[model samples]
Target: MSNNHNPAKPLQSILAIMAHPDDAEFCCGATVRQMSDAGADVTYIILTNGDKGNHNLSITVPELVKTRMKEQRAAAEILGVKDVIFMGEEDGFLQPNRELRRRLVRHIRKIKPDLIICQNPEMFFSGDRYINHPDHRNAGLVVIEAVFPAAGNPMFFPDLLAEGYEPHSIRELWICMAPEPDHKIDITDLLDVKIQALRQHESQFDDLDEMEKWVRERWSEENEAGEQRYYESFKRMKFD
Candidate 1:
């Protein structure tokens, strides 16, 4: 995340596709903030309504959905994201199915972002303590599938083309929480910005201070000379 080790450039536009409202914030908030600061028009696509994330039995599913959407918008605004699109897929039951892929293709074709940030489709589990969320894996798969063979191929969805969402292909792809990340971007300066964005999701956390502390300590690293740094790593791919 230091020096020329990074991409050394800012993109024209970025789209972060995630399984839930807070997923993008947790995975790539700081990176998105940096990109937006550098003048990238950033848009977020939350694939699920995030209705199931709350444990409060008093809150109904429909109410939670509306609340989460509001929180997501506030969070995205804080990060300078230009737009937030909620796919409204049921939480926890997302699948990498044809319907979703086609829908994603339509969105991708319309957004026409040069860079896309997504989660890891192949990750079924993480460390010994956690099993990766099904929605996360499925969301990644849906994005990748749409980006490939679909969004760029007019034949995949002829209706989309007729509707004027002409075939569009992204120039670069970045996967967060990838098993093997080859690149890291320094986000040491946007730590506060990231925290503020995450804070917008008020219904997700019971203890805000504790959550903030965890986030700070999670990505912080110190060099030999006591210089602390933070980063967001990604698996990057480019197309000619």
Candidate 2:
């Protein structure tokens, strides 16, 4: 991750599919920013509206959804994301099903991205002993399936084709918070941008400084072990 300028052209487009509003920011904001700065078109597909992400018992679900959506848009803007798509699924009740796969496939075909970024499908338990949310896990599975035969095979979703969305194949996929990562990006130069982008999710966090400190502490370990001052890790999957 030593800022190795390969002189190779960057991938043209990237689509990040995640569970909630802040999932993209918490998991891969730095990496997304780095890609955008390098001239890659970055897009986000948020699965849920994050209706239940508040501890305030007085707030209504609709109110929380609106607030979270606004925060997520602001955060995406900071990262230079080209577009944000919301699936509008219910929070905390996500299920990996054919409908979810179809919707995800439709986006994949429409976006026609070279790289698809998403959460790790296998990460059900955190090393910190925190139980991973089922919605996150569900989104991961749906994304993985959507990136595969569902998106590439026209027969799987013929209606999408009728709507003018042709099958689009994605060759490279990256999984965030993967237990085994084979790829790493140096984000040292963009740490400030990443922290700032993450701060946009103000609704989810009470203390921005504490969140920033947590990010530094987590990435610092990877930075020290790798060849870069700061790095974001990913498990790379290749279709070809």
Candidate 3:
């Protein structure tokens, strides 16, 4: 277990596989920005359209999906992400099914990313307050299944081979919100960028100031010098 940067090779490309539009922004925006600044090409694979994210009954599902995708694109742009791919799965109903796994495998082989940052599959509940979203857990499982025997093994998806998405093995996987995180990336200097990226989800948050305040309070901590700092922790796994 190592907290410092543990990838044997410098990251050249990164792919964030997540459940919803703002998932990447809320979880790992600053880290993505930092990596992009350091010359890594970063792409986001949003597994769902986020159609059920809003409480306004007046808005149609199609309308909400469009709004969220626009917001997600803007947020990824703020984080300097190279591309954002929306998988358009129905909101609140993602699954680690064979169909979804094949789709994810196609992307993994096509992107050939050095690092894949994803959700945590086993987070069922948080303390006594929040029940983890089903989509989140399923999203994590989808990525895990794809990254294993499916994406790297040519035998798993013979059709993808014809599509020219060759088998590609990843170097590392960083699971966000992991219960036993062994790696923590300090983003003390990039807190503003992280919050700014998240604020792009206008349809999701009613009060920008309140959201910003909550985020700072939730993610910040006092250092030995009594100065506040920010970091995102993950369970990192390296491959052979």
In order, what lDDT does every prediction score?
Answer: 0.90, 0.86, 0.91
Q: Candidate 3: count the clashes.
A: 0
Candidate 3 lDDT by residue in tens digits, 1-240: 112553456788999999999999888999999898877899999999999899999999999999999999999999999999999999999989999999999999999999999999999998899999999999999999999989999999899999999999998999999888888777888889999999999999989889999989878877678887788888999895
- RMSD for each model, in Å, please? 2.0, 2.1, 2.3
lDDT of 2 by residue, 1-240 (tens): 243223464567999999999999878898888778778899999999999898998998888898898999999999989899999999999998999899899888988998898988787798776898989888889998888788988898899999999999986888998887888877778888888988888888888899999988777644444554767888988765
Q: Model 1: clashing residue pairs?
A: none
User: Which tens-of-lDDT digit does each residue in 114-219 have in candidate 1?
Assistant: 9999999999998998899999999999999999989999899898899999999998999999888887877888889899999999999999998999999987
Consecutive 10-residue window with the lowest summed lDDT within model 2: 1-10
- Give the best candidate by TM-score: 3
- What lDDT score is found at residue 180 in candidate 2? 79
TM-score of every candidate: 0.94, 0.93, 0.95
In candidate 3, stretches whose alpha carbon ends up further than 4 angstroms from where it belongs are 1-8, 223-226
